[model samples]
Target: MRVHQLVVNFNATAQKLVNWKMIRFGFVLVVMFTLVCTVKSYTFQIPVEHDKNGEAYVTFDGTKHWLKDNKNLEYMDAQNCTVHLELFALPTEESNAYVSGWRLCPQEFDKIP
Candidate 1:
């Protein structure tokens, strides 16, 4: 009878150990998944290119989430404008000084469609 009781106790102990290990493994998997998702969401790339007239421009890439438009056109006579990252850093000007080809545009051009 004593030998049978010992065998039952050992089985119960082994089951508890297995459950504990499974819980720990599940927690680790959740943490790893969270880390990967956060990293992917935070960072994005901008696409930059130059035209035949040597004008640099920054455009968005829809396929790769988002891409950076990093083109240093400070010296060049390009109409490329910086897409502001912060809300307060955006240009306050009503119209761009370097822009052209819109001389005859209607006064209510900014009205929403």
Candidate 2:
């Protein structure tokens, strides 16, 4: 009888430990999923406008960055003024000039069906 009681108690304790671990794992998963959904990526877009001299300028983070690349013009022309900017690891001298990293979103992505 005593051996049976000890076995039953051990089983109960093991079950409780398993339940506690599952609860902790579920809590961690929820926190990770929330962080993934809410955290913004380094990539974002800024408005591009042409000045009177036809120079391209992008307003980023409340600062106006004048672009000086011919590729930027080609991108703007190709994307019909829609462009996505990816920030570089190191800051450049041209303020927010459109350097190498640029992504053009598909036009159909925002289309209303």
Which candidate has the highest TM-score of all?
A: 2
Q: Pick the candidate with the highest lDDT.
A: 2
**RMSD to native, candidate 1:** 16.2
Off by over 4 Å in 1: 43-113
After superposition, candidate 2 runs with Cα above 4 Å error: 41-113
Provide the lDDT at 111 for model 1: 56
1-113 per-residue lDDT for model 2 (tens digits): 99999999999999999999999999999999976654333234554566676666666535555665433322343545444443332233444444333434556447735
Candidate 2, residue 77: lDDT: 35
Instruction: Give the alpha-carbon lDDT of every model.
Output: 0.42, 0.56
Q: What's the lDDT for residue 1 in model 2?
A: 100
Clashes of each: 4, 0
Residue range 1-113, candidate 1, lDDT tens digits: 99999999999999999999999999999999987775454344343334465343334323211112432222211233222221111132322212111111132234526
Worst 10 residues of 1 by lDDT: 96-105
